[model samples]
Structure formats: structure tokens, C-alpha cells
Target chain A: MLAFVLRRLVQSLLVMFFVALLAFSMFRFLGDPIAQMVGQDTSLQERERLRVELGLNDPVPVQFARYVAGVLKGEFGISYRIGRPVDELIAERLPATLELSFVAALFALLAGIPMGVYTGLYPDRWLSKVLLSLSLMGIALPTFLIGILLILIFGVNLGLLPTFGRGEVVHIGFWSTGFLTISGLKSLIMPAITLGMFQLALIMRLVRSEMLEVLRTDFIKFARARGLSNRAVYFGHALKNTLVPVITITGLQIGSIIAFAIITESVFQWPGMGLLFIQAIQFVDIPVMSTYLILIAFFFVVINLTVDLLYYAVDPRLRVHGGAGGK
Target chain B: MNGMENNVAAPVADTAPALLEVRSLRVEFPTRRGTLVAVDDVSFSLRAGEILGVVGESGAGKSMTGTAIIGLLEPPGRIAGGEILLEGRRIDNLDYERMRRIRGKEIGAIFQDPLTSLNPLYTVGRQLVETIRTHLTMTEAQARRHALDMLKEVGIPAAEERIDHYPHQFSGGMRQRVVIALALCAGPKLVIADEPTTALDVSIQAQIITLLKRLCRDHGTAVMLVTHDMGVIAEAADRVAVMYAGRLVEIGPAQAVIRDAHHPYTRGLMGSIPTIGRDVERLEQIDGSMPRLDAIPPGCAFNPRCRQRFGRCEREKPSLIGQGDRAVACWLHEQGEGAS
Candidate 1:
């Protein structure tokens, strides 16, 4: 098991290396950062002096080496637009995005699984049909459209909740969380639902189809023949069998939730790394944009590694060696 | 169809009450086209400690009858008529929960492919323990010990160690042994072994059949062994039931049926088996396939395929005519008695 983990770690490092290389190219390929950072009135000598001090005048390889070294130490340089360390800016926005994504993920899992199981167990029931149809719309509708429609219904028309931004955050150490406040939670509902909608539908459909397939397998019939209760047959036998695929999809989807949170963040004006990344892009802020790219890639690699390990644990067939112990 | 009167006169295990009795049992699958009868008025009895081989061509509803007895018929296929009784208790119409209680406790099942029968995620020992505990009032430790004993009983080497291994770790034959162990662990009075050796290797098939027969005999568990292999039936079954296109064409003592197959379909089946020294160019083959559920011909289902099919055989379905320990559902037998 230790060897298995180490091997995955090495693979993850290799993937992160490639992403870092891609991020490094953005620095050289994108337009000059000095032009964007300095004013028109600044003298050519001042600009040249600033460029040298920032190591922009150095060879591309030397600059890339410096950037890689800074990334290794969790430093992503100063944002051209903000004039602050890119990591610090990310740190300030990280908590909100993490909280929002976590809540959205939790909601999707809690609701999607049961609905999937229900629809799977009774594919022809009236309630199952309705739930299935609703899930289709959930997958079909765009995130922004759903967000706007929800804002119109509950925010603009009903006047029941806030439509944009994280509300009433309380700071504890470096982490500022909206969980401690009611306004924060109330403001969270719309965005969390919007972000989770597509994933919830996807999880539901995958789970439902997988459940249907698992139920038809011979082991399930053998389980029933053993006179196991319906609960054991459906949940213990069929549900567990469906979980391997469910876990795979959910893991990949969680990565996407964090990466593609840009649209959701934009619609709600939620202050998070995604919004920061978008602002960085608009200003051609190389440090923040490249760092964000590398960070998202890191999430994907870590999640993929975690997923690979989870399969080994969940499915014995994937384990490298047969167990030597007995019950 | 008059099976109830002969319930007390089961050929084997004389004086023992019938362990399982099916009277006019009919299984149907309701499709959009119409109601397709899969098992039509199939009636038979299994005596305690007796092995009844339900032999037939594929699609003859041999598996269906076994599946029906265990109450595991897949959806849309249901026992549309008739009844099934176990030791005088009516079980065909019991509620789902009640039937589930009877399953694994009163009746266990061993299916064809052992590879797919056991859940892959769980160890073989865990599966056996769960089944044991479900039907027997045993603690976890007791169940585990019992499971080990079962694995050992099924001839699995290193039972103490291999018990923790998953199903895939074992070969096809060993897996079937584990399946038999699971089915018999709870000491179910009757076992429905549906095509148990069909999915095994040729060499492994004989071993599995022998294991099943020995286990069932030792435990005094009656078995309705469903299979299409006459060779397997000859080796393992004490009594034989011949089915064709969802109807019982012939049923009697296994030896008697193999020696003097009264029905033309049964004769055809027996002739199809090749002898070791025979120099024939080709072995005997049945003329036609079993009819589909939706298109089974009227009267006798086997008429289209029977070389000896007569006019009346095509007009009127023949019920089992002989009495006592033997019977044949054919127009020739019916007419022979009528003429005599």
C-alpha cells in the first residue's frame, strides 16, 4: 500500500511538472507585463530599471527557473494589477470558494444518490419519472441561466435572499468563513444550487444507470436467492457494486466543480479565486493567471491520484496482490 | 396435471412425504404482443433426499421451473397459475417478505455460473457467513467457524486461509464448490440447482456434479437439478423429467428413461448421446429447435420436431398417461392404452 501511494505521488509530481511548464510559457508568450504594470508618464529609464529589478530583462530560461523556484516555495510573484503577492490574494479568496464548492458537493451527493437509487429501483413509477425528467432539465440547463432564473424568482421577485457575493464573513486566523453568519448562509443557497445543479444531475444519472445495471447482475440474483432482505440486496449488494463507477465520476466532477466555478462565481459575484482569475485575465495579470492555471491542474492531479487509490480500496479486483490473511 | 393424487406415491424415498410439489405450475412473461407462456402446466414432485434431474433442450423451461420454485423469477415473468407447495405448506402465493424468509432457510439455490454467482467485492467466507447468519440463529464468530467448515466440506484446500479470498481467486470448479457450500450451509430442506454444471469445464463438470450429489445426499436435501445434458442427468440424477418447449414430455426413473425412452422426444434425446466405439458418420440430432414462447405450436409442443408425431399428436396435447413410478405424455402411449 505504501508503495502504491508513492507511485501515485510520483505520477502526480510528473503531471504537475507539465502543468508548471505550460504556466511558465504564459509568462513569455503573453504581452509584456511591464507595459501593463507601468503608467504612460513613467520614463523609459524608470521602466527599464523596473524591468531589470523584476528580472524581466533576464534570459527566458533564467526567468522560467526563477518562476519555477518561486512556485516551489508557494510564491507566485506580485500581481501586475494588484501589486500584491499572487498567493496572498488567492489566500484571501480561497476560503469562500472552498466553502461554496464543499457545500455544493455535499448537496449534490446527499440528494443525488437517493434520487438515483429511487429511480433505479423503480424506473417506471410516476415519482421516478418526474424525478428523472427534472434531472434531465438539471443537466440540460446552463449554469448562468439557472442562476439568473433562480435570482429572479427568489431574489428579485420574492425578495427573500441576497443574489450576489458572500455576506457577513467572520475572520478566524487566515481563513475568513461565511458559515458562522446567517446572511452568509442565506446568500450561499442560490450559488451553491446553481453550481451543484449540473453535477447533481450527472451523479444522479450515472448512479441510476449504474444501479440498474448492477441490479441485473447475477450476484444480485444470488444475493436475493440467499434470502437477504430487500435492504441488503439493494443497499448492501447493489449499492456497493454501483459505487466504484459513482466514485470515479464524482471525483472527476468535483475537480471540474472547482475548475469551472468561474461561471457560477461570475453570475453571483461570489468573491473567490475564479473571480480573481477572471480579473487577472482581463488585466493580463500573468502571475495570477498562470498561478491559477497551475493550481487548478494541481487539484486535478491530486484528485485523480485520490481516485486511483480509492478504486484500489473499493474494488479488490484492482488490488495488486492477493491477500495472504484469512478471516 | 393430476399430480396431487400421486403426491403420496413419489417413486424414490418411498414413505417419505414429498419435499416439494408443483401442481399445474404455469409461468408466463407478459410482453406487449401478448402473454407468452414459458412454463405450461408443468407438474412434478421431489422426494426428500432424492435428486430429480429436469432434463430438456434449451428454452424448454427447465430453469424456469427451478427459478419458480425458489421464487426468484425475474420481473414480468410470474407464476400465472397453479401452485407450489413445500412439505404441505402453500408457498407459491406467499407475500414477498414471507417468501424471502423461506429462501436460504427452507430452500437454497445453486445457479450455473459460479464465477458470476458470488459478489466480487466480498470474500467467499464473508458471503457464506452472511448466508449462514441470515438463515440460522448464529453469532458472527459461530457463523465464521461454520463458514470455514462449509468451505472445508466443499473440498476447498486451505479452508482456514482461502475462506478470506474473493470468488475470482478460485478456478471455475472450486467456485462452484463454494456456491454449493453457500446453498447448503443453512441446511435448506430442498435445493434448486439450475444448470449447475453448464458453465464448468468438461473435466470440472463431472467433479462438480459429483460434489453436488454427495452434498445433497449427506444433508438429506432434495435437489431439483435442472440441466440439458443427458450425460449429466445419467451420472447424477436418480429420477428424470424430460421437458420439450415448456411441457413435460416424459418423466420416470433415470435408469428406466435412459434404457427405454417411451416418448419420441425422449428417445431422440437419448439417441443423440454418442457411444464410445460407435462408427456412425454423425450423431443423432433433434429435427427442430424448441418453439419460442410467443410461437409455441398448439396441442403437443414437440409435435413439429417429433419424427413419430401422428395426426392426433398435432390436434390434442397429451398429458402424462402412465401411472405410479413412470409416465409419458405422447399420443402413442395414450392410444396404446385406449386400443388395449
Candidate 2:
């Protein structure tokens, strides 16, 4: 088992290396970052000075080595437009995004699975038909449209939740009494729903279809023949087999969520890395944009690796060797 | 048709009652075209400790009869008319939950294909323990011990060690043996083995058939053996029920049915078997096929295939008739004074 985890860790590093290289090259090699950063008003000598100062005149290999060394030392360099440390800016905005994204995923898992289970178990029933149809419509609707609709319903008309932004972070030593982080959670509800609604639908449909297929397998019949209750046959025998696909799709969807966060963050004006990424891009901030891209790629690869390991644990067919004892 | 009229006839005794009595059992399906009758007025009785072999060609409703008895038939097909009495208790059309309890407890089943019967993910021991646990309220250790004993009884080597092995680890014959162990784990009174050896090789087939017969005899359990092999019926069955076109044309003692078949269809079936010590010109093949459920022949279903067909055969269907030990379904036998 230790060997298995070590092997996975090694593969994850390889994946991250390629991702970081791509992020570095896409911003550094192909595009003229210094020309764009210096703008049209700079004199020829001024442009040369700026290029040398930013290490653009150095060889590509030297630049990459410096970038890797800086990354390893926890220094992401200064943003070209803001003239502040990228690490501090990201640190200030990171918590809200993490909380919102995690909450959205939690909501999706809690809501989508039951709906999928019900639809899969009773395909021809009226409730199943209605849920299936609604899920289809949900996937078709865009995040912005859904966000606007939610703001209109709950924010403007119902006057319940705040439409956007985070409340103050109260501090009492290390812990706060008015952890209105919980209250901030309320403000994030509408945008999180908009971000997670399509994923819920996509996940539900995949789960429902996969579960329907698993229900027809021989093991399920064997379980039924044992005279186990319907609930046992479904949740016990069928559900375990259906989980591999669900884990796979859910893992891949996290990558899509990172991509979707750009739009969601802009729509709701939530202070997060996605909004930071858009602002940096608009201002031609090479260091900030490269760091964001590499971080997103790193998250995607790490999430997929965790899911792959989980899949191996759950399915004996994919186990490293003979399972249990196989490292 | 005249071969099995005299030897080992069936006797109706007032003293011994049938442990499982099925009378006028009919199963039908509502297809898009019309109602299709799958089992038409099939009747048979089985006493405790007796092995009754049901023989027929494909699409003869043999498996359907087994499914109906176990209450496992899928939707669109249902019992149209029947009385399935187990220990004098009516069981036909019983509620699902009630039937489910009786299925693996009172009446266990071993299907033909062992590859598809057992769950691929679970170990054979796990399945055995599960079945035992469901039927009997035993502790996990108790169930495990019982399962190990059963695996040993079924002649599996290293039963304790192999209990943890998955289904894919065993060979076909070994898997079938595991299935038999599962079916017999509850000590069921009646075992429904539907073509249990049909999927096995010739050598393993004989071994499985002998094992089943020996197990039933020792436990005093009745077996409803469904197979198309007449040779197997002669070896393992106490009585034989011959079916064609979803109807029972002849049923009697195994010896009588093998040696002196009464119905034309039965005679054709016996004639088709290749005797080891005897040489014949050619094996007789039953002419034509069993009629489709939707397009059954006008009157008698076998009239088109029967070589002894007469003018009256086209106008009337035959029903089982007898008062003594044996019953035969044929117009020729009906004419005789003591033919049954």
C-alpha cells in the first residue's frame, strides 16, 4: 500500500511538471509579455531596460530555472499592473473561493445522488420522469442566466439572501465569536447554486444511467434471489458497483468548475482567484496569470489522482495487484 | 406410443398424498399482438423424496414452469389459472414478500448456467453465508462455519481456504458444485434444478447428476429436475413428465416412460435417443417444430407433427385421463377399457 501511494505520488509530480511547463511557456515563449506590459509610449532604450529588468533578455532555459526556483521558495513574483506580491493578493482572496466551491460540491452531492437513485430505481414512474426532465433542462441553462434568475427571485423579490460579496471577518484571538463566515455563507448561496446547478444535473444523469445499467447485472439478481429487501438489493449490491463512474465524472467536473468559476466570480463580484485571473489578464500581468493557470492545473491533476486511488480501493478489478496486501 | 403402456405404471393411492401438487397450471403473456399461452393446463404431482424429471425441446415452456413455481417470472407474464399446493398450502399468485421467503427456504433452485448465477464481485463463501443468514437468523461466525461445512460436503478441497476466493477463481464444474451447496444450504424440502448439468461437459454432467440424485436421496428431499436429456432422466428421475408445445402429453414412472412410451411424441423422443449396444438405420427426428404460442394449430397442437394423425385429431385436443396408477394423453389409449 505504501508503494502504491508512492507510485501515485510520483505520477502526480510528472503530471504537475508538464502542466507548469505549459503554463510558463504559454505566457513566456510564444507571446511578447514585455512589449504588452511596457505599452506603446515607452522609448526604445526604456523598453530594453524594462526587458532586461524583467529577465526577458536571458535564455529561455535560465528564465524557466529562475521561475521553478521562485515557485519552490513560495515566491510568485510581483504582478506587473498592481505592483504587489501575487502570493499576498491570492492569500487574501483564497478562503472565500474555497468555502464557496466546497459548499457547492457538498450541495451537489447531497441533492444529486438521491435524485439519481430515485430516477434509476423507478424509471417509468411519474416522479422519476419529472426529475429526469427537470435535470435535462437544468443542464441546458447557463450559469449566468441561472445566477440572474436566482438573484431576481431570492434577492430582489423574496428579499432573503444577499446577492453577492463577503461580510467582515471578525477576529477574537485565533477564533472569532461572530464567525459571520457563516453569514457570508448565506450571501454566497445564490452564486454557488448558479455554479453548481448544471453539475448537479450532469452528475445526476450519469449516476442514474450508470445505476440503471448496474441494476440489471447478475449480482443484483443474485442479491434479489437471496430474498434481501429491495432497499438492500439497491443500495447494498447495486450502488457500490455504480460508484466508480460517479467518482470519475465528479473528479473531472472539478476541473470544469475551476474554468466555470471565472464567469461565476465575475457575475457575482466574489473576490476569488477566478476574478483575480480575469483582472490580471486584462492588465497583461504575466506572472499573476501564469501562477493562476499552474495552480488550477495542479488542482485538477491532484483531484483526479485522488479519485483514481479511491477507484482502485473500491473496485477489486482495478486493484494494484491482488488487492488488500498488494502494494 | 404403445411402448410404455404396461411397464411400471403410475398408481393412485389414497394413503400417500403428494407433497407438492400442481393441477391445471397455466401461464400466459400479454404481447403486443395478443395473449400468448406459454404453459397450457400442465399438471403433475410430486411426493416427498421423489425426483420428477420434466423433459422438452426449447420454447416448450419448461423453464417458464420452473420460474412460475418460484414466483420469479418477469412482468407481462402471469399465472392465468392454476393450483400450486405445497404441503397442502396454496402458493400460486402469493404476494412477493411471502413468496420470496419460501423461494430459497422451502424450495431452493439451481439454474443451468453457473457462470451467470453467482455474483462476480463476492466470494462463493460470502454468497453462501448471505443465503444462510437471510433464511436462518445465525451469527456471522455460525454462518461461516455452516458455509465451510457445506463447501466440504460438495467435495470442494481446502474449503476453509477457498472460501475467501472470488467466483472467477473456480472452474465451471467447481462453480456448479458451489451453487448446489448454496441451494442445499437451507436443507430445503423441494429443490428445483432447472437443467443443472446442461451447461457442463459430459464427464462433469454425469458427476453432477449423480451427486444431485445422491444428495436428494440421503436428505429425503424432493427434486423437480428439468432437462432435455432422456438418458439423464432414466438415470436420475423416479418419474418423467414429457412436454411438447407447452402441454404435458405423457407422464408416468421413469422406467415405463423410457421403455414403453404411450404418446406419439414420447415414442418419437425415445426413438431419437442412440442406444449404446443397439444399431438402428437412422435416429428418428420428431417432424416439424413446436407451434408458436400466438399461432397454435387449430385443435391439437401435435397433430401437424404426429404421423398417426387421423380425422378426429384435427377437431379435438387431448387431456390426461386415467383412474389407476398411470395416465396417458392420446385418443388411441382413450378407446381401450383399461389403457391407463
Candidate 3:
């Protein structure tokens, strides 16, 4: 198991390297950063001086090597627009995005699994039909639209909650989070719902279909014949078997939830990396944009590795050779 | 010979109530075009400690009859018109909860594939203990002990060590033994074994058959053994019921049915068996396959494949005609003075 984890770590590192290289080269092609930084009226010599200061005068390979070396030493170059270290800017916003994704994932699991089990158990019942249709609507409607609709209902029309921005933040060392305050939680609801809606529907459908399939298996029939109660048979036997596939899908969905939060953040003005991303793009801040891209790619690899470990933990069949002992 | 003697002794004292009784049981499956009859007017009874072997070809409805009695028939298929009585109390119409209580307590079921029957996620001991605890009141420690005892009873090597192992750890025959142990652990009055040996090897099949017979005999639990192997019935059953195309064509003491089969279908089945000492150019086979549920002919479902089929056999279905200690569903048998 240790070997397996080490192997995965190496693979993830290779992936992150490729992702960083791609982002670095792609931004260079988007247009000269110095040109975007200086005004058009500036003298040619002033522009040339700015270019030299920024090390834009160097060859492409030399620049890439310098960038790689800087990144290795934990230096993501200063943001051209903000004139601050790109890492510090990202670190300030990291907590919000992390908190939002965590809350959204928790919401999706708590709501989606039960809904899936219910619909899977009784596919023809009226309640199941209604919940299934609602989940379908959740999937069909886009994140930005859902965010606007939520604002209209709870913020604009009902006057029950605030619609835009992080309300308050509590700083702990380098990490700052909004969940420590009541207003922060209230503001979190709309964006979290919008970001979570698609994941909820996807997980529900996955779990429902998987449960339906597991319920028809011979082991389930044997479980029923063993005189287990309907509840025990459904939840204890069928649901347990359904979880492997559900966990796999849910793990993959977490990566998508983070990606999708960009639109939701835009709609609600939530202070997260997603909003920073849009701002960085608008200002042509190549360093910040490239850092964000690499960071998200790194997150995807880590999440996938965690999912593989989880598979070993949950399924005994996968833990045959040395896996059990390692755990 | 021992099985035949047991059969003769079965009816000696007729006062004891049958452990299981099925009266004109019909199971049907509803399809897009129409309802397909899977088990048609099937009726049989099992006395306590008696093994009734139900032998048939594929699609003969033998397994369906067992599933119907156990109330585990897959949906779209149901007991259309029938009564199943256990100790004189009707069980065919029990609700899901009540039926669940009866299963593994009153009537235990053993399916064909051992690998599929046991959950891979759990240890053998856990599954056995759970089933035992569900039907009986016992502490977890006591249940675990009982599970270990059952494993030993089924002849597992080193029961104490093996009980903690998963189902995949056991061989095919060993797994079937574990399944048998599970079915009988609750001391159920009856066991419905559906082709329990078909998935096993020829050598292992005999071992499982003997194990099942010995266990049932020791516990005095009646058994309904559903299989397509004639050899298994001959060795394990006191009485045998021969089914053809969802209907019982013959039922009698194992010796009588094998030696003097009255129905043409049963005769053909016996003839199809290859005997070691007897030499023949080719084994006899029934003319055609069992008819599909949707296309079963109007009269006797077996008429298309029956060699002795007559005008009456092709025009109308024949019900069981009772003789002394035997019954045959054939027009020839209906002509006898004692026919019913």
C-alpha cells in the first residue's frame, strides 16, 4: 500500500508539472504581458525599460527555466495588476473556496444519498417521481441561473437573506474563513446551493441507478431470504453494495464543483479564487492566472489519489495483497 | 433401496399433518402481450423428514414453484391462484413482514449458485450469526458459537478458524455446505433447495447431496429438492415429482417413478439417462425442447414432445390420476378403474 501511494504521488507530481508547463506557455501566447501592463501613450523607451525590468527581454526557454526555478522555491511572481505576491493573494482567497466546496459537498451527500435510496427503492411511488423530477430540474438548470433565482426568491423578493459577498472573515494564522460568523454563513447559503445543485443531481442519479442494480443482485435475494427486514435488506445489504460506485462518482464530482464555482462566485460576488480568476483574466495578470490553473490541477490529482485510497478502505476485494496490512 | 423403504414407511402413519402443502398452485408472469403461466395447477405435499425431489428440464417451473412457496418470486410474476399451507395454516397470502418472519424460521431456502448466494463483503460467521439471531433470541456470543457449530456440522475443516473467512475463501463445494448450514441453522421445519448441486462439479455434487440429506434427516426437516439430475433424486429423495412444461406429469415413490414411469414424459426422462453397465447406440431424448411460456400449446404443454400423445392428450390437459402410492397425468392412466 505504501508503494501504491508513493507511485500515485509520483504520477500526480508529473501531472502537475505538465499542467504548470501548459499554463506557462499558453499565457505567453495570450499576448505580451508588458504590452497589457503599460498604457499606449508611454514612450517606446519607457515600454522597453518596463519590459527589461519584467525580464520579458529574455529568450522563451530562459524565461520558462527562471519561472520553473522561482515556482520551485515557493515564489509565484508578483501580480502585475495588484503589485503583490501571487501566492499571498491566492492564500487569502483559498479559505473561501475551500469552505464553499466543503459545505456544498456536505449538502450534496446529506440530501442526495437519501433521495437516491428512496427513489431507487420505490421507483414507481409518487414521492419518488416528484423528487426525481425536481432533481432533473436541478441538473437541467445552469449554476448562474440557479444563483440568480435563489437571490430573487430569498434576497430580493422574500427579504430573508443577503445576496452578495462574504459577510465576515476570521483569520487563524495564514488561513481566513467566513464560517466563524452568522452573517458569513447566511451569505454562504446562496452560492453554496448554486454550486452544489449539479453535483446533488448527479450523485442522486448515480446512487439511485446503482442501488437499483444492486437490489437485483443474487446476494440481495439471498439477504432477503435470510429473513432480514426490508429496511435491513435495503440499507444494510443493497445500499452498502451501491456505495463503491457512488463514492467514485462523488470523488470525481468534487473536482467539477470547484471548477463550476467560478460562475456561481461571479453571480453572488463571493470572495473566492473563482472571482480572483475572473479579475486576473480581465487584467491580463498571467502569473496569477497560471498559478490558479496549476493549483486547481494539483487539487484534481490529490482528490483522485484520495479516492483511490478510499476504494481500498471500503472494498475488501481490492485489499487482497498487502493492502490490508498497510492500512 | 433405503430411500424406497423410507417412502413406503412415509404413509404408514397418515395422522401426522404434512409439513408443507400446495393445492392447485398457479404462478404467472404478466407480459406486454398477455399473462404467461409459469406453474400450472402444480400441487404436492411434504411430510416431516421426507425429501421430495422435483426433477425437470430448464423452464419446467420447478424453481418457480419453490420461489412461490418461499414468497420470493421476482416482480411481474406472482402466485396467481393457489394456496400454500404450512402445518394447516395458509401462508400463500401473508404480507411481506409476516412472510419475512416465516422465512429462515419456518421455511429456509437454498439457491443454485453458492457464490452468488453469500455476500462477499461479510465473513461466513457474520452472515450465519445474523441469520440465526434474526429468527432466534440469542446473545451475539451465543450466536457466534452456534454459527461455529453449524460450520462444523456441515463438515468444514477447522470451523473455528474458517468461520472468520469470507465466502470467496472457500471452495465451491465448501461454499454450498456453508449455504446448507445457513438454511438449516434456524432449525426451520422445511428447506427448499433449488438446484443446489448444479453449479458444483460432478464429484462435489454427490458430497453436497449427501450432506444435505444427512442434515435434513438429523434435524427432521422436510426438504423440497429441485434439480434436473435424476441421479441426485435417486440418491437423496424418498419421493420424486416429475415436472414437464410447468406441470407435474408424474409423482410417486422414487423407486416406482424410476422403475415404472406411467407418463410418457417421465419415461422419456428415465430413458435419457446413460447407465454405465448398459450399452446403447444413443440415449433416448424427448422430441423437442420445453415450450416457451408465450407459445405453450393449448392442450397438454408436453404433447408436442410426447411419444404416446393421443387424441385426448392433444385436445385436453390431463390431471393427476391416482393409483396406489403413485400418480400419473396421462390419458392412459385415466382409463384405469382407480383413476381420479
Point to the candidate with the largest TM-score. 3
Q: For model 2, what is the error of residue A186's alpha carbon versus the real structure, in angstroms, after optimal superposition?
A: 1.6
**Per-model TM-score (chain A alone):** 0.93, 0.88, 0.95
Residue B79 C-alpha lDDT in model 2: 92
TM-score of chain A of 3: 0.95
Candidate RMSDs in order:
3.0, 4.6, 4.3
- Greater TM-score among 1 and 3 belongs to 3
If the candidates were sorted by their DockQ against the true structure, best first, what order would they fall in? 1, 3, 2
User: Cα deviation in Å at residue A33, candidate 3?
Assistant: 2.0
| Model 1 alpha-carbon drift over 4 Å, by segment | A24-35, A40-62, A320-327, B1-15, B277-281, B335-340
Query: Candidate 2: lDDT of B116?
Result: 75
The pairs that clash in candidate 2 are A1-A327, B3-B260, B4-B260, B4-B261, B10-B325, B10-B326, B11-B325
lDDT of 3 by residue, A1-327 (tens): 899999999999899888888877777666777777888898999989988888878876677788778899999999998999999999999898989998999899999999999999999999999989999999999888999999999999999889999898889999888889999999898888889988899889888999999998888898888898888788877888888888888888898788777898899988899999998888778789978988999889989998999888777677764311111
lDDT comparison, 1 vs 3, better candidate: 1
Interface DockQ of candidate 1: 0.51
Query: Each model's TM-score, in the order given?
Result: 0.94, 0.89, 0.95
